[model samples]
Target: MPPIFRAPRYLGASAIAGRGALPYLACVITHARWTSQRWFASVLIAMVVLIAVATVVGAEMLSRTTEVSNRLNDRIAPARTAVAELTAAVVGQETGVRGYVLSGEQQFLDPYAQGRGDETRLVAQLRGLLEGHSDALADLDAVERRMASWRETAAEPLVRARRSDSYNVALVTQSKEAFDDVREPLAGLDSKLAALRAEGRADLNDSRRLRNTAFAGLVVALLVLIASIAVLLRVVVLRPLNELSAEVRRVAGGDFDHRVAPRGPADLAVLAADVEAMRGKLADSLAASRQQAAELHRSNADLEQFAYVASHDLQEPLRKVASFCQMLQRRYAGQLDDRAQQYIGFAVDGATRMQQLINDLLAFSRIGRMYDDREPVDLDEVVGRVEDTLALAIEETGAEIVRPKLPTVPGDATLMTQLWQNLLGNAIKFRRPDVPPRVTVTVTEDAEKYTFAVADNGIGIDAEFADKIFVIFQRLHPRDVYSGTGIGLAICKKIVEHHGGQIRLDTSYTDGARIEFSLTK
Candidate 1:
């Protein structure tokens, strides 16, 4: 099937982030010329693509921020604290050495021993903290060398000289100058750790800002997309629908002349056009139906007048001719020649047949029109009456009639009786030579109706003549041979149709003639 809505082709997988996607979508939206499906798809695809990209970017930024925060809190901060404590430990060692040299107190050596222990532990811990950091580890190595050299050459010598009572001022000055070398490296290490902490905090702040900006932009884009969809729907779907609905209402409110103009998307426009076409057809049909109803009313009036004439005027003349011919026949039976007798017989037969034709025609026309006294007509009783009416024919033909226990149906008793009578009489009349006819009436029922089949074992009708046998006056054999006006099946057709049913020949029944019909249950 052809595509109906014809949404934009760019709203596909390959076009999710295609360069032309946004431009084309924007153009259509700006021009207000898109179908609902196209606009919806375009907007939806744009939203999904942008949101996906934003989410991925935001996640990366968030991860970066978390890494930076961890470095600042765990590595950089702890390394700075260790450097500061190491600087304080070296200062304590210098102070203790100077105090011991000045006063020769043994207790002043305690701070020197404690500071040495702190320096060793701090150097190891800081080395671990700055293991992978080349610049920080270089600065930490320099600080450790300076502190260890100061402890071995300056601090240890000063403590020993003060303990031996030979600590001079020059020696104290030399120790203080050596301690300044340790301070210099410690300061450089402290400065390097401080720079690292500052850089980590800056990276963390930048990552957080970027992540927040990405999320905010995504939210804003979502709001814009939703608003755009709403606007597009209002312009492309809702307005047209409202207009179409109004037009439909106008047409339905007895304004058949109102034309439904096409609007909106291609699908909606097609729908509107179809509705308009239907309206035109309905209007034309209504006018034609009214005209035909009027003609039919006139035709029915003429038919009633014709029926009156055929019943009274035509029947009277026919009876007179038949009666006068019989009288002449009785009077001049031996006097007239055989040719004259034959001519007279022909006239009488023609008049009698003409009367039959008129009666049959009148009966056919009067069905369902003359009366409507519908009731539950027992088909079994109707068949029994028909059998009684054709009792002499049945006896002579020795026809066997097999019938099931029939059900009651809704119809006029007289019409139902005529229906069976005509069918049964035809079966009896059409018997094969020297063959006793066998007729079976069977019934099957369903939810809505009962189907009946009347099958007769006689000269079966050909499949080609199945439709022809039901037409009025359409006889297959000569009048003398079949003895019917050929209106029997036609009358049956009318009677069945009048009762809201259908009758047709069962051509598949090759062994005999079969008639199947259905009636509403």
Candidate 2:
């Protein structure tokens, strides 16, 4: 046999690998898409969650800041009023002392007492209001110090003058100068407190701006992520898989010549390569098988032609020798000696056997030439015809032919007739002398082929020669014991083989010989 061209195995493996990889890659891609979608969705959800959190936090912070600012603003005004009240009280005390000293009126003394009391209470309240803040506290301390200096240097001196009876008018002027000297410091302290409040408001505004900017950035980033994921899925997963699917459809349609173009990632590229290799190998294998079949057909035709010409040419010489030998025996048998007659008889028998061999060769060649014309042939009718032809031999041997119902097969009528004749003849010829020949013909059919069996109770062949008996010119018996052209079984083999079928023999000492053949249905 030609080296079993391991190409099919390689192609089969490649095809299997290619087909298997496609689904694997598809599963991978599907999982990737689902996972990627989930990831994108999760990121978006996380972003939204963060945005919500940030929004809530920012709103709370802004609300709190606004509330604090409003509270600060409200406190600033109250603090400013307190400072103004304290300043007014200090100024009034100075004016009252100056008036008492310069106008010599006791009524101004009441004003001084009222101013001192109010100034003391206003300074205490201002200090309480500024308690928590060092900056505000420093401003309050400056105002307090300035008021104390004004009371000591201006109010007390003017009051002393009024009590001393010297009543100097210069003292009243000196007290007014002292009040003006303290006014600048108290105003500077109030200005510093206002600046601090302004800085706090600026910080709160900056915080709100930062929160808005962060939220906007988060939204943009999430949108970009979603868009990127969509693009990735389309490019990497969906498009490549669609291409693979199209290639698979083409292959299914019997276009094994098409090659898949490599695309996508590493695994998909490998799959495409495998598919291409499979197509190449399959095409090569199919081409080789076609060439092999064509060569085999040519060989068979040549053998059949040779067999027909050779057998026809051989028959003419054998016929002349047999006819001449028989004529000599009939014309001169009495004059000839026993030895001469025996030699002449031997020539006749040899010639006759040679003629039979040539005829068997012709029949064997005809078996190969016969083609299935596919007309219905009733096998039962064929068997009956064979029985009629072999009637004399059957009666002589007392052979009993048992034929079961045989199916009608699509076959050539003449070839099937010849087939039954040869098998039935073999059955009668090889029978045991004491036991009557019992021959049985049966048939069975399956979806694709039909089997026919011809069984006989005869002197069976040895197991060793069973297969050899179907070869041309192969014989198992001596000429004296049994006579045959040795091509009968070979012809049967050829006929079965020509019909895309096979033949075999079953033999045993007790059961005799059974010939079985199968033909395509």
Candidate 3:
């Protein structure tokens, strides 16, 4: 396979060995995590570049817009104003010349002199305004020449003739013709200025439109980029994560046969591969565990059946042995020696104890298959019955059993009774001589179950024997000292376990032996 297609190595030995989900998850994350980081970084950089480019384009557009505004404000508008002023000055000259030629009055001469002064000032201003405009400068020169001709050839000569009292009608006609010649050029200059102003306005409009377009494009690009990021996040991250979460839930729901397929980006795909691998290993482990448990259960069932049958069968022989031994002891009491009578007594006691041991074993084995009609058993009622049964022992030992109101729990009535009977009997039997057996049974209830503590102010069990005491036939005291088959607490353990609760010696209790157990409520 190509390098890109090759599988990633796990970070730890456990991951490579396909152990539990934790290592697999860690390995998958380590393998596939950074691809998303790089992807995000690339997108961010692209956005930055796009913003920078848009900014540059917008700046250039704004600069062009400003240049257009300056052209209209500074060049075209002022030049047009200068052209209008010059035209008015030339018109005034024509007006003055016509007046002098017609009346030859001194006031008309004053008007003529004023027109010349106005012309000089306006011409200088127009020249300055049109300094860089070659076409406007040519137009200004033509106007200047036309005005000079009218002033010198027509107005000046006619004015001189009239002053000397030699002015004629022909001179007046010539001056009028010269003044009319100036009108055409002034009209041309007006058209030129109007065209320049219109062109400046058009250029300004185009620049503004360009700037608007650039801004609109920038906005559209940013919107598109944001939308793209949202889409990418959904596709590459959210969707895959949701799918993976659902897959995990299915696995958690005990669907060991369910498989996770590789999907999404390379990293997520690798993660999926790791999860699938873990799932397969877990499925195998669960299958093996279930197989072992089934075999163990069958073996225990067979053992229990054998024990029940053997103990039931042995009881007849044990009874015969004890009866025959007692008959011998009674019938031959005087005839036999004291040693012979003691031997027979020992045999009887041995037979009786063996029978009791067999009976205890039978009871223990029956715990597995006996309780078929399980229901809610009230511990208070069960403890009351236990107290009744152990009334003789409690009275003889002067035991004070303090049992508070107890919660009702789901269990078998017979088994619950047996459990309490065994525990209370032990408390009564194992009392300290100095103190009356003060056995207190209390219950604490929580959401899931009820925890019961049977405490007694008796000789407490040693810490080393806490766990040992719950095993069948495991007794801390000798049979003569405790007078039991050593299976009472073991029976309690079995019953609690069968009901899906735990029974343990409360090692934390220092004053006495506190046996705590729980039952599903």
lDDT agreement with native, every candidate: 0.84, 0.75, 0.81
Instruction: Return the lDDT, model 3, position 60.
Output: 91
- RMSD (Cα, Å) for all candidates, in order, is 9.1, 13.7, 5.5
Ranking by TM-score: 3, 1, 2
Clashing residue pairs, candidate 2? none
Q: Give the alpha carbon lDDT tens digit for every residue of 41-72 in model 1.
A: 99899999998999889889988998999888
Mind sharing the TM-score for model 1? 0.72
- Best model per lDDT: 1
Q: Report residue 51 deviation for candidate 2 (angstroms).
A: 15
TM-score quality measure for candidate 2? 0.51
Q: In model 2, which runs have C-alpha deviations exceeding 4 angstroms?
A: 1-272, 275-301, 321-340, 443-452, 500-502, 507-509, 518-521
Q: Count the backbone clashes (under 3 Å) in each candidate.
A: 0, 0, 0
Inter-residue clash pairs, candidate 3: none
lDDT of 3 by residue, 1-521 (tens): 12323234544554444445444454555565555557677788989999999999989989988987887788778777766776776777777767776777777777667777877887788777667767767777888898899888988898889789898888888988888888777777778778877887888899899899999998999898888889988987789878988998999898988877555666776777778877888899999999999999999889877886667777788889999999888888889998898899899999998988888887887785767457888878888888999998888888898877887888789999999999888877887876889999888888898898999988999999989999998888887787887899999999999998999999999888999999887
Q: What is the lDDT of residue 112 in candidate 2?
A: 79
